[model samples]
Target chain A: MPDVIQIKAFGMIAEAIGSDSLEIENPGTSLALKKQLEAQFPGLKSMKFSLAVDKKMIQEDTDISQGKEIALLPPFSGG
Target chain B: MDRFERQVILPGFGPEGQGKLKQSSVLVIGAGGLGCPVLLYLAAAGVGKIGVVDGDVVSLSNLNRQVLFGEKDLRKNKAETAVRYFQDKYSDIQWEIFPEFITVENAQELILGYDLVIDGSDNFPTRYLVNDACVLMEKPLVFGAIYQHEGQVSVFNHGPNSCNYRDLYPQMPSAKEIPNCSETGVLGVLPGIIGNLMALESIKVLSGFGKPLKNKVLFFNSLTSQTYEVEISANSDSKSSIPETWKDFEQMDYELACEGIKQLSWNEAMKLMGHDVAFVDVREPGELPPLECTGLMKVPFSTLSSQLDRFEDAEEVLFFCQSGIRSQKAAQQLQQVYPDKKIFSIRGGINALKS
Candidate 1:
């Protein structure tokens, strides 16, 4: 079994999903995990989120470890 | 006594939230109407450190809504006035003022040290920049915005429970599509009501007292005196999508994102106003203000994408909105789809046309 990654969202996206956190089985690569998340959260098809692994944004297809913290950050609205 | 009062009475606050407030550091962007109330209340509440950031000086028009200044403050920096006001009202609290507007270049550094961020800005670019910086810094942000009689408030990027602003608006709408207060006008008291809500949310977040609007959006309609709350959930697709660097932030140019198209002045658009040139309003039907122009077609911006086929015969197209921001975006989109046909936006929009 792959390790699980914890993710969270807020504001409009939260309103759409109706919850703040999701636990997904790490699928080895960020791309696979992204696909799994999209299937679970359909509202993100049109939205943009900065993907961060353990609070640091990752651009490349990095390997995911067990129990790593993942956050899907939506565009900010505050001034 | 109120629960808030009980927390105030504790050792640091002495029966008021003053002490907790005194220890708290808050950065307020924009000294306009919304900033006015946020500044006044937070200062009065005895917040310890307050930073006021704004680039513009006081204008006669702002006097109507910005309570922080008066006739004497005209042409004077807004951040300076706010600092002076807080200093005079509560000498005990430490206040700092940044007279320059917060920009993408300095936002992250300036916002990193603050405990909380209060957004009172009027534009989308600044708002998005602030949200991204706060999320990067792991700082709590109290968000508020007012359009006519409606206002919205939310706590963003506080912690595991926090949400970012982009979750609410995935993309920026062209500036021309939306009428800013400068063109549309607003009630003087609207910002006060909204600013107070921002203060309330900030206080809630700082003291960890009541249920903060974290991950939730609360909308207030002053016209009908109704309040609505919407639940916002975490977007799973957003996972693994955090912007990796500052360069990524620059990639999303909100000015271009919201208003992607290019535009020309009214005079420039008039040159092409013949049979070969098509004019599309890109505004809602009722939103079309009275304007005297020939060879113009009215199509609200929302439906412009779908109605593009109607103008297939025209060699060129011109788009206009109240301010020209939306029209530019429309033109940009049209240019992408029809690379051969020229699409132009009327700068300053219909308001300019009428002028």
Candidate 2:
């Protein structure tokens, strides 16, 4: 079984998801995982969030591993 | 035994922190509410070198929150008044006053010499410009902002773990969607709270103290007196591809970034209440003082994007939040998806609803 990746959303995104973290099987790539998450949570389509693998921001099409924490960050309005 | 004696006794910051602060240089943008507390605390904390950047002159209305200046200081440049005030109180610290607003052309060079940048700027363009420049220079930024009774504070670009402001807010809301502090009145202590937090974070970064909120956002709600902490992670979609042309940066006007959204003043929106215009309150479900409109609907800001289809039949839609910032962003998103639908933001949000 593939390791489950945990993703967290903050600020506006957190308020949208209505929860903090979303756990799912580690999809091969960040884009794939995003699509899967969006499919699961239809509300995610309207949100403009960036994917962060582990703690740092991943710009390239990177793969997600087991136990890694991913964050779906919305545009932070906080100063 | 001195007023700063307690702080001086802390580890790392004991003698070195004091010396670094005295020798360190900081450039603060804006001399308004946020800048006022930031400047005051930085000077009070004995930062050796301080620079004040702002072109606006002190005004009578600023007295409510801009505690650094008074009626007598009105008509004087904010930077000049701040310098004078700091000099009188802390003669030991060095001060530089820039009586001009930070522009894209000067933002980079002006921010280069400073060890840290504090963004008290109110507009989206200035904030983005500052963040981009700071990221390019690899300088840490202590950011603070206030809307109504709530405030946000964060530290960006301190170290390898640092995240730039863009990491949090990748896109800038259109100017038509957002309002300046002047447009939306801020609570007097809101900026003070956030500004002091900026100072605290800066000190932590400078002195290497307790875990700084590097890559994390701290939120304060004065209305409910509650605090929420959120961890910020880097985003993949950010335009890491820096443009090759200087004109590109200049032309990248944040005001025009998110288009297709219309803006309506409170009065203008009120006039359409009985018409086909639909009002959507995008605040949280439990957000206080539910918007009181005859034809208004509540769809918390977070859910508006996913629930866009709910208003399919509406000829026009109006978005609003506590202070209009979130609503403006919502309208921008709505415009992106529903090009045919006329989406508008209520300037000053619910605060203006009454007016």
Candidate 3:
């Protein structure tokens, strides 16, 4: 069985991806996951968001474990 | 019977906590949605002094979330009105008003006077400007922002070891890709929830009672009524990206820095309107109060793709919508097709000119 990771998107990221949460095949690394998501959602290509793996913001390309919950958090401009 | 008797009586947050709050001053940068509740609670909680800085005047549309203003307050400077309201109805906390936005020129001077800052600014430029200024000045910052149903709250620069906003999102998202509150729309209560949390964090940071959101960014979804947080570690690259000195900071141009697609002010856009320059209004066909400009093309963003042939001869194209959100999208889309043409989006669009 292909390992799957759960992704939670917030704000405009959620709107662009069409859903707040989704399941995708584990992309192994944080950078790969970002590329995969961007390839699927053209709207996200220009947008900037922080990827959090297991509730920790990832600064570098870190391996993502199977079944982990990853969050896509974007900075909000509105007050 | 003291006015702070209720809060002062709580265990672990007694006389000492009250005293701490009574001595700390906070500068709130924006008197809009989030600032209203933050200022209201901070003043009620007996913060020693509060400074309200906002260059915007209270328009009729601001009445929904900016509860500090009334019909009589419309057209008055937001900072001035907020200060006046607090002075008339709230505690004896000393109130200071800037009646201006926190620009780089005044950011250092403004932040230097306060111990902490609460950023409720609406745009990325101001947010980044405020964050860098607070980090440079070495002040604790309570940050809150809302977009539609979701909100984010964080405490940055709380200590030497704490992470700031730069560590969370290392790069500022291009202004072209993002829309403002007016463009996307927001629930009236979203800012209320986020702003109250910011106020709570301010009190926590000031009194040293509960754990502040230091090194943590809280994400709240009002739709699900759930809260989640991401642990922040100081990214060395992000930390180093901040300008080292006041001279370097003053030279920073936040607006241009955040712009991926070149953005022109109304005045700048007007200067290039004629000749081979094409001015495109990308708002909907019937958006409102038509833009009466010389040689302007009415190309709604929805139909921009099929109208590319219309701009075949133009050397430069400028896009503008009601508030410049859709125009930015249009400019980005067109820039991809015509890589050699100079495509720009007019900042703030027609609504900005109206205001």
Candidate 4:
């Protein structure tokens, strides 16, 4: 059985995925989540963003447990 | 009687805190939406010295958020105009005005003169350049940026366990990958709010009155009134990218470093219409009013790889799409195949030609 986690998308990520928040089966790791999300939304494949778990940004692959607060944060370039 | 009597009376931020602000200097880059509020508040807060750096001219569209500029200020240099206007209002504060954008050549020297830096720049190249320079110079940087209805604020390169902007997201997205406020449109209030938060952070960093956003980034959404903070950790990969010496720093080409490809306007593209250039439209087949130009070909981006041979005989290739975004991607893709070839993308694509 796969763990279900809450995902919060911000900025362009939200626009690309067409939602600000959603729930999906956990991909188990940060890198996997990025790959799965990119494959799921082709629009995201070309963009750059960082993934955070429970409010801490992960620079490398990290395990994801059920109900972890996963957030997709994209950098805003405008002033 | 102290001019800052009200602020000087605050509990933790009393005479000492006011003194810190009165002795500190800050360099503000870009005097647009975000810089206006930051400049005004910093001056009002009694900062000792302030420098304004902006190369752009005041346009009619800027009046909404760039409150410092008026109709009379139109067509005037932003940095000079803003500095003079605020200088008139606050004669006590010393001012440094640079009516030019910050470039790699001047970044280090310009930043070395100030104790702190505030980046209100609107583009990715300048943001990365400023962040790297701040990190290298060991100066505290107050950073703020806005999108359509959201904004981000953070204080970088401060405190013991400092984390810079690159630690949050190591790679700078290619130009046009994420649309800026000008392209996507922003509510004037969004930057105003973000800029205020940035100004507050700058004060905190300088006066040591409050806990600054060290190792953390604050994100705000105006439409939903939602706010969240993300903790950042130092990444060696990001730190390694910063130049260790002045020579290396000066040699860095920020424009090419940010993947900023050559983009031409409709008039410029039209000039080469009948020349030895191959104009390729990367839009999908049957996609609304097709572009009609001399020596034009339709090659959808989805099948671009399979159609590479179609442009083998052309001296140069120009790409266009519905909105110029995809066309940039197409140009980048083609350039990878023909590194020495002159490849260009039309800005705003067909929509630009029509409107």
Candidate 5:
């Protein structure tokens, strides 16, 4: 049994993901989740954006097995 | 008992801080949503001189967030309007106005004169250009951006090892990838919130009261009421991308750098109707006014990637959204998938088809 994570997308990332948020089986660490998402969305793989878990931008492969809120923040060009 | 008595009472922000603010000059780019508040707060703070650079006009839609203008000021130039408003309220400070867009031709002159540059620009090319200019000129830039319900605030080029916009994200994405305010729409209060933060950073940097958001990017989500502070590490190599020579900087291809996907008019789309091409309706299902064509099919841009197999029969594809913005994004994505195939987005989308 795996924890279900709610991956919330923003701006263009939402357009890439189709839905604002998707519940997916927790793939473990932040890096693993990104790999899972990239595999599901090839377009997302090449897209230049950052992933934030629990409202913090992750630079390292932090763990996310608790199924917390993950936000895909694309660079906002609007003001 | 004076006009500035209220704010001067704060311990850390005393008469000396006020004096520093009264002696500093700040240049604000883009007098739209973010610029309005940044200008207003910096003006009220009694900054010695403030330069406003914008070529946009006040329209009915701007009233929702650009608080400087009222219904009466509609159609007036934003730079001119802002100068008038600030000069009227705070006559102590000098309001410098540049009633034109900051391009590669004029940006250097406009930016270098001011001690601090506050970027409220609305597009990626301008944003990156500003960052490059700030890096080259060694001017501190207070940056802000807004999306639907979220906003980002950062201080770039202000201190040693400080991360500029390019340091965070090195290259500019295609224009089709970014959704401007006109295309995706932004919350009225989001820019205000972020602009105020920008102003706060400017004051902090000017007065030396507190630490500015030098290398950190602040992200805010209005709906969730959540705030995230992302620490951006300075990439020493990022500065290398900025043109070393004036000639190189002048030759930078910003327009081609921010190029959009190819667009097709209704006539062109109609011409391709009889051919073996996939006419994609990127709009969500049940969108009004059905598109009657020989090979029209519904494949919303969002779900299009998942259902690419549906369009396997066609050698080419043409995507159309409600207003043409999303379709451009769809076509750009498909173009990457099938680089050899001809892919286009219908100009003005189905709305143009109606007319």
Candidate 6:
């Protein structure tokens, strides 16, 4: 396995990230994965968001598995 | 057996549920898009008391989603107009009008006595404040947010297993990066779908008839007519983010939390009529409610790139539109191209200045 991860974005996060979903190489942990994403898309460094693995939101460093579905969600202000 | 007889005769909801609804009080935090439909349904359902909190006046551009007010109601305070319009519709229900924004100074006072708080505010600062205030007050909150064709609705701080907004995302994005509805157009019907869901959730919570959205968020994509639910869990860090006391909450800076682009008042914009400032109208030439005073070169926001050379001779540039929202976006675009030049958007646009 290449240890690849599937990514999905919603709302403003999708707006900034262009495509709604993509594949990225895993960085071992959820925290490390976010660092890799910010490096690729610098806009994410300034945004407040959370990462969801297999539909569950993760707050701390967690092991990343191959074929895990990840989602980047931002706080939406629209009423 | 009157106007409410249909719902009163429904399966699970009877006179007792009606009684609970009649006894319940709800405070809706904003009077715009989401607040309008939420207030309408609650009023028609005979919610005992409904309070509305908003400091904005109805501008022309708000007519799309804010169905409560009309042309005659324009320029009137939103909180007052929505309350008064609904007050006469229902005799048994009481409508409370708070013509003010829900600030830290007033959040607790406005939310404490109410049975539940429904957040319909349109900015990050207000959304965060509402979430934190609900958590601190120990009150149930029905949260809803819409972007373009998608909407998210959740019931937070209500049940034992419920999750607050902070639990979902602990940090708030800088306000400068986010766009309001004016800049990023929203489908007019989307808010109705979300706001009505909020009202339904509120009623379910108050009457104890059905399960409200506890510890879960419903994401609806109107474009495809599909809804996806994300099961959320409480985060320990989210709890720590809440201010421990009202004193700390009072010291919080909401403006700095949700800062937008640079803004100038209409009068300040007009003061540059003869100066080195280049007047740029970001709105299309045919857009309604044209500027009362002339001399502004109409460079539609959609075609701003090719027209950048027009302002080469100016020391400063002022952007304005029908309601001032698009102008701020134009200023941001120009700022990127002309980083060294001064740029500002008139705060309320020509609509605010016309009268």
What CA root-mean-square deviation does each model show from the true structure? Answer: 10.4, 9.7, 3.8, 6.5, 8.3, 5.0
Please give the CA lDDT of all the candidate structures.
0.71, 0.74, 0.88, 0.87, 0.81, 0.83
Model 5: TM-score, first chain: 0.88
Interface CA RMSD, all predictions: 8.6, 4.6, 0.8, 0.7, 2.4, 1.4
Maximum-DockQ candidate: 3
Q: Estimate each model's TM-score.
A: 0.60, 0.63, 0.84, 0.82, 0.73, 0.79
DockQ of each: 0.07, 0.20, 0.77, 0.73, 0.39, 0.59
Query: What is the TM-score of each candidate's chain B when compared with the real chain B?
Result: 0.71, 0.70, 0.82, 0.78, 0.75, 0.77
Question: What tier of docking accuracy does candidate 4 attain?
Answer: medium
Ordered list by lDDT, greatest first: 3, 4, 6, 5, 2, 1
Q: Which 10-residue window in model 6 chain B sums to the lowest lDDT?
A: B253-262
lDDT of 1 by residue, B1-355 (tens): 5324654666653644555666789999998889999988887776778888886667687888898898987667788888887777666778787877676667876787689999998767667677777776788999998765567788998788666776655455444434457655778887889899999889878766567888777766666676756656565444334455777764554444455554565666767778788888887777645554676688888888898788789898888887565777778778878889877777656655543
Better of 4 and 6 by TM-score: 4
lDDT of 5 by residue, B118-168 (tens): 999887777887888888888999999987888888899986777788777
The pairs that clash in candidate 2 are B22-B48, B282-B301
Tens digits of per-residue lDDT for model 2, A1-79: 7678787765445555777667777887898987887787786776665566765665557877778888765443322
Name the candidate that leads on TM-score.
3
DockQ pick, better of 3 and 4:
3
Worst 10 residues of 5 chain B by lDDT: B253-262
- Give the per-residue lDDT of model 2 (tens digit) for B1-355: 7667877998666877877787788999988888988888888888878888986667677898999888898667888888988778776888888887676667767887899999997766567778877776788999887655567788998888677777777656534433456656777887888888888887777767677888877767676687766677776555473333456555554433444455566767877775677788899987656757466788887787779888788888888886566887788787777788878887556544432
Candidate 1's DockQ: 0.07
Better of 2 and 4 by DockQ: 4
Per-residue lDDT of B1-355 in model 4, one digit per residue for the tens?
Answer: 8678999999999999999999999999999999999998999999999999987777678999999999998767888999999878977899999976788878987899999999999878789899989988899999999989899999999956799989988987876688787678888999999999999999999999989999999999999999999998888799788888778888876656777577776778878765678989999999766767666799999999898878887888889987566787888888888888888888657655644
Supply the TM-score for candidate 5: 0.73
